[model samples]
Target chain A: MKPEYDLLVVGGGPGGALAARTAAEQGLSVCLVEKRPAIGVPVRCAEGVGRDLLTEFMDPDPAWISAEVERAVLVAPDGYRITLEPSMAGCEVGYVLDRKRFDRDLVMQAANAGADIQVKTRAVAPIVKNGAVAGALLEQQGSVSEVLARVVVAADGVESKFARWAGLETAVPLSEIETCVQFLMTGIEIDPGATVFYLGNEVAPEGYVWIFPKGDRTANVGIGISGKKCRSGSRPIDYLNRFIKSSFPEGRVLEWVMGGVPVCRPLERTVADGLIVVGDAARVSDPITGGGIYNAMFTGRLAGKIAAEAIGRGDVSADGLMPYDAGWRSSKLGMALERNYRVKEYFITLSDEKLNRLVHSVSQIDLAQFSVLGIITELVRQDPSLLLELRAIRKLL
Target chain B: MLLIRRDICGYCGCCVSVCPQGALELIDAYLSVGEDCTGCGICARACPLGALEVADEA
Candidate 1:
């Protein structure tokens, strides 16, 4: 007989794991399906996350963090640098994490909360009954089965098909996708506690290069370029290689990873009858930075709470899940994401000259006490003409 | 051999930036490999456009 669950989460990434944990904590029966044979295998991230963001819902364990970050180095195309020091950076702390361990920890937390986790289980399609999602057809280890649930949360990553299957308009235009590639390297000369961001069209075009230190003279160095600008027939690896050879001439790469970052605004809606989507699955990543962990977990918590409430009310419909939207939007994560999206679009459309000019302007700011958003707002304030561009970008936010 | 489809390349230069062997170069807005091309396939994977095609060099 097929197992029944009050909630079935499709994907055991950060978002799904958190959703499962949240729902189970609320006393709802939850089952999580992970397509990967083991959670967090073939790790695909720069693994840089804010300490404070993760702590809001769950405390950080030493096993998951590689290093404590204290500074951020912003470099322009011409090699001009701006340093954001630690004293004024507040608890907006940063950490380079062991992602595999981090993901496993989340799954462990969910399992401890009583959610059933099945590995190597893929959700093939939503099982629709009477015009609503009843459950999903799952393929496990080459065998197929079905599981029924009252509520389903799609926490799949950036390339989520579940949203489209659930009839949500989840397509991200190429212009809004950032092609990223990272190399884990050793023997590099860099500050072990500072994260570096390289900006300029010459180096990364519409995207940027990042050097996130992983500790002990190693770092995850990578670049992400806007897919629309990538139409010029240059791949991200080509750009990364050139940068590494020139910048870190003595660095030796130990591993390589290539992936996509979604820079689009959050989806118009994240809920449907018997369904909720969180994290990258719902385009909940930072539109400007392409970071998803914090937002993913935040949305996951909202989805989990709403799912539990719906199950408790015996009403797992679209309207029942509306609270998830309201709750998440009211949270700091949502506001930051919305503002970041506006900031991202503004920077994405800038030409090389404009980028250099913007960087030059930014270098004059005392970022120690200012958030990136505040800096942008100040820039707009200085040049009132930028208000027009800000207004156009604000619509998407 | 990896063939990069010109239409999809983002020209973000990520491939050029991460290549370990210095095999790729940006010329006329397209990524071209020199004789030292290692066929590492990293370039293809790094291509967000899915523009790079990696096949065994015949």
Candidate 2:
């Protein structure tokens, strides 16, 4: 029997939804399968994203934005602070999203574009025939059914098994993964127009604590620590609770969320014969920030468009899908992720004293604007020895 | 019944997502197997850390 769908997208997050919508727009028969009863619930992200990154794919929808940030407040271990006007010099602070609405709208777009969306449906395993993925065995409501497709797009977030099942090495090293946990709290005093980042090993070990305001008196406070650096046996939640008690003792408890973040380069291999992996499954999140939504949607749209084109040409093999990999790497999103990973590697090696000094120096510099290059220049000026470090790091890369 | 390997559990909560019965909860960063568990073994299969295993009930 012929395949039931031209594209079967597993996991209906930003990536899968966009992939399904894009494929359907291209006139391909698309099916989007999500394990949850709804697309976005039990929200797991910190939800801070730059406006430019978001506008690249879709317009600014008011239904999804929770708060507008004007600046980024960076705090050091010893309480030193450096505040940067994010929107100036193109380093925009952007907005924290209401992910439930944001995610649901994206999936709705896919559905409106003519993709069949199945919720509470889990893809148990990929169906392989003649050494290539043909579809998946789906389990929904205690019943199992095999859904056939010409191509499969895996966007199953951090614990994706589709890529692994398709013979790709998606295993992220402990050093490259971030164990993140967050709490949405009320009764907190926040700038409402600024996001706070607390640094220093004492605060969160190799990770950092963030306060992204949702409103005048509410925020999503969280921490993300490197898995390898979590040696104290204290969970991220414990660290967060400690930080909260000290910072916002009167804050009311609300909700708790936990998830793993892949803080590495995009997967070395995201495409296999008749299979394509996008978003978190492909490890497209930023190594330093652990932000994946924008990149997920970008890569998803690219994958869907490429899948449609490849299907039209009747070549669904690995060679045919190589363009998706090449396209992602060549995009601005891909370039930024690679650069950030290197920056993160270098930053993690600095001592707390050095970090405090670096921030202090930048705070003193009367720069009229803020940009990544501007910050790097300030760091280099504060310590000329970093030039040698940068050169060595470049050679290693 | 479900068993969790405490030493290996990073408590990332992937198993909680795949549980059809909502039988798993991460309390204080540990998997707390609840009464709703039907020994479906789905959590064990979905755990990224390989920290969960299922056994026959006595």
Q: Which predicted model would earn the best DockQ?
A: 2
lDDT of 1 by residue, A308-368 (tens): 9888888888888889987787787888788777777678777766566666676566656
A1-397 per-residue lDDT for model 2 (tens digits): 1238999999898999999999999999999998777789768799999988898788988889999888898898889887777535655759899999999999999999999999888887799989889899888889889998999999988767677767887666666667777889999988899999998887876778999999879999999877666533465666888899999999996877678777878888788989999998899998888889998999999999999999999998989999999999988888888888888888788779877876787665546635554566677777888888767445433
Among residues 3 or more apart in sequence or in different chains, the pairs in candidate 2 whose N, CA or C atoms overlap within 3 Å are A86-A91
* Candidate 1 segments whose C-alpha is farther than 4 A from its true place: A89-91, A366-369, A380-397, B1-58
Q: Score residue A87 of candidate 1 by CA lDDT.
A: 68
Per-residue lDDT value at B47 in model 2? 45
Q: What is candidate 1's local distance difference test score?
A: 0.79
Residue A223 lDDT in candidate 1: 88
True contacts kept of 1: 0.13
B-chain TM-scores per prediction: 0.82, 0.90
